[model samples]
Target: MTDRFYSVIYTLSGFAIAPMLVLAQSPVILTGVVEDESGAAVAGAKIALVQQISSQTEETTSGETGSFRFEDLSPGNYLLKAEASGFDPYEEVLTIRSQETKPFTIKLKVGSVKAQVTVTLDDEDEVSTSESNTSSMRISNDLLGALPTDAEDVVPLLDRFIFPGARSAEGTAILVDGVEVAEMDMPSAAISRIRINRNPYSAAYQSPGTGRVEVSTKRGHRSHYEGSLAIYARNSLFDARNAFAKSTPDSDRRLVQAKFGGPLPGRRSSFNVAAERLMNNESAVVNALTLSGPFTMNVPTHERRYRTFTRVQWWPTELHTLYATYDFKDKSRENDKLGGFNLPEQGIRTSEFGHRATLRDTVLFSRNVRNELFFTFQKEEQRSGSPATAPAILVKEAFTGGPSQSFGREKKETFDLADTLTRARGRHSFVFGGRFR
Candidate 1:
């Protein structure tokens, strides 16, 4: 009976100590030291460890030697953070493995309280009053979404958003990613931000005195696919008649836009495409009671516009990026005089086509320096004419109009190469750039 009792007691002891042995064999130790920028030990530094999977946190304070240790930790990922008085916080990510010991050194920089000094640059610092005084406005993506827009075009939107005193649709220079674009052809859906610099004095701008419109497009980093479609229409049925007109003027306007963007599979690439079309028609009658009464003379006009844009981007590494973009636009307008007595056949037709292609590369030489190189090629053609075969329209008591012919055509091609380098040193940042056109 005593022998049996001894066997049972030994079995119970073995079962009780098995877990302790298993845990002891898988020991993990994490040791770290906290030091200031001067390499002096920082005692009383608070250290915290956060397990990634379990989200458990353990806290400890450094000893007199500025050393802290965590032993018998389970193997897992952890976030280690150190904090001390009058010093910036330090944080690092580390992994703990079973039966492994690792050591870390945490260096804390002096807090801003230690040195309270503000340095400003004339051209680069926004708060520097010595530079040319100008007001700037930023249009955020949230605001853009809240604002109403008729189509994907931003020119009209910008004109309406800017203050009345600062509004200048033609004088404002449009820039995309710091590059001047001939026109605002990018879709609104793809725009990430817009900045309006009123009365800017920066030499980098094309016409700083007039103003500048800077636009940034989305990079499509967060989403795998994104697209939007919009359609707008207006007709005379919902319009009010003018007091001078005999009847309501006939008018119709329509717009359609589509935009899509997403990341490509593999190689860290992305692409974006946008297309838009607009059509407008209007007919109006001039009331001349003394001449011939209502409908004596009529004017009709029609306009059509088509635009498309595409962009592709690739990131070969963390320090390098490349971009290619293409834009195309076609527009045509026709004006005719009709429904007038003894009126000759007359009309004016105008058409324009524009194309632009750009390539850009961005490289980060170091944490403090960056370089950007870009090339752009643009082509534009315009034609306007009143055919010789058509006769000029005439109005009673106005003047005798004869056959008239006029033709004009213009074509332009431009190429630009530019590079910009930016470097930041102690208390100063420098930007140097040049462009060849």
Candidate 2:
């Protein structure tokens, strides 16, 4: 009976310690340090581990020192991934062995992230960590396809949201490739990006960036050619008539845009061209009372616009570059401001044309010093006149008008010269710029 009791006690003890033996045999750990290419620690990096066999995923973030550890992992093939802001993602296949500790060092490269001081290491082995304090929103080419930018009238939709504080277009500043412009005349396909509210405090701008829109154009490829054509059309096929109109007003709108870019024979020079044509027509309901009787009619309004942009980029040397661009626009409209209480005879016709030419030169003096010079010339002429010579008359809310007051003529010519120099030292950047118009 004593021998039987000893055997039973030994079996019970073995059973209770079996789980601890099993757990102690599978001690696997993974450790890593996340760093940038400059050897600076990348804090708050996301680290993920996936087991190949069990398909289990484990996620953790790096500590302030950029160190991460995963303890008590099962021995298997795993996919290790690390990612951080402003840096490219990292991935590696790790084979973990039982009762082993594996250590790794992950070095991430800089990506397309924009910063005030980019990838500059000082003599003290310190990296530039200060970033822009302003908030900015960017719309790339992928998003521009869905926006209502095919028509001139619809372009204001973005202004209403982007520059809500601006009272008018003149109050908001527009920049194209670091150069101030009165308008964006290039085709949508040629546009690469549109950024709002970027660098509000820089002295390079005449006004703050809080009410600014910056446009960047697509660059020409050195090895291949690219082109795109876009056509947008609309018509009043299924429409409801206005409550005051007898039938649905005839409406039609069409837009065609084409863009092409290619490198020159030497590949050191490139050119890009874009052209657009727009035609729009709409019927305006005229409800008015005249000396003869109540007059009601549908007046057709017509608008036509043509715009073209051409740019040539030449690289004289590895450190020096030049850009020349020309833009032209022509517009005509019939029956302007002739709706509602205004009669057909009160319609106004408008015609306008504009030309813009710009030249830019860039020189890189050193790794942290740069200079840029810009010259631009713009000319515009516009005129508006009523179709009828008769003067307009008003009857205090009652419809009475022989001619509209939308007649004006203006011509403007502007020349601008600007220069800027930038120098980055340690964690500070100094910019000196001046503009003359």
Candidate 3:
């Protein structure tokens, strides 16, 4: 029995040590340099190496020094390939051994000529390559899809991305597709990306870009139809009672957003449309001490908002394109400020309606020259009223009475036009534009 026990322990220990021995095996290192037929270093050359047995591939690009390295490779046969623009492809097979370091030299010859063309417009195709002086945060569609659609406002979602104390007293500047707007008029589903520019000081905008938020809307697909609908809802039945409320006040919020995009009837033309509806009804707990004694109640409040946006794109010629967009918004709120120490009579009702229209044209004059022109018109109307006409009354740390002090009507109209020209020469790019509002 003792001999059998010792034999079993030895077998079990060997099983444990076998894996460690395998894991301790040394890795292979493959390093190489790419060069042209003239023996000149070929920078930015693409390098691909594949393990024949595993069919696994690894890729890298040659640096300015024309050197590349791949580490931790297993011992195997590999197919090596290198490619670069204006150069012929190079291929070879390499056999690597464990714990071995191997070096290779690859040479590429000039390839046949190929025709390629690309069109770029002012601001629309601007690409940034430097990250020294600017920082930006982007919120893509995938991130937006994870957020609650029933959210009452976008500010709460945006606050986290802005730099500390970056917003000015006047608030951040909002630009939708290079056009400044008073507010976002499209649903979240219609937004392609939301970007925050932390170091915007360019002259293109009316305000500095330091606290600017740029929003780009999705474009219609020219070939296929795409559509989506999202609905969000929450009721009081699933919510816990508020600490100050007498009971679980009846409250509910519902939101619906739908968007569709597809090709239009004409060639090279497309259209995108989106709409949203939100209805929110909630109760606010009020705990106050009045002349009659303690006054406690739940004040019911409601809000409704509607928004619609439509965009059309048409290509009159191969080098010229036109875009038009229209947006409408309507919102109303009842008992806006009737909670806390203020009584229901002090509640305020407010309504707002707005319409915005825009037209843009982009023309490519040459391979290196482009021009863009755009115009926008907007009209906004607002009205608010109070239930009681008396002046407001307040007792420190106690109660408040009388009507809300906010009551007014206002109307405003805006007209904006801008034109820009861009020219690129070699590595340098020049841009010129002016705005009228």
Identify the leading candidate in terms of lDDT: 3
In model 2, the Cα lDDT at residue 171 comes to 56
What lDDT would each prediction earn against the true structure? 0.73, 0.78, 0.81
lDDT of 3: 0.81
lDDT by residue (20-138, candidate 3, tens digit) is 77865767788989999889999999999998988899999998978999988888799999999999899999888765565789999999888886764432342222123357777
What are the per-model numbers of colliding residue pairs? Answer: 0, 0, 0
For candidate 3, the per-residue lDDT at 318 reads: 74
Candidate 3 global TM-score: 0.72
Which stretches of model 3 miss by more than 4 angstroms? 1-115, 120-133, 148-152, 426-428
TM-score of 1: 0.62
lDDT digits (tens) for residues 139-187 of candidate 1: 8778986777654455777865445555455656777866777677755
Angstrom error at residue 181, model 2: 2.0
Q: What's the best-to-worst order under lDDT?
A: 3, 2, 1
Sort by TM-score, top down from the best: 3, 2, 1
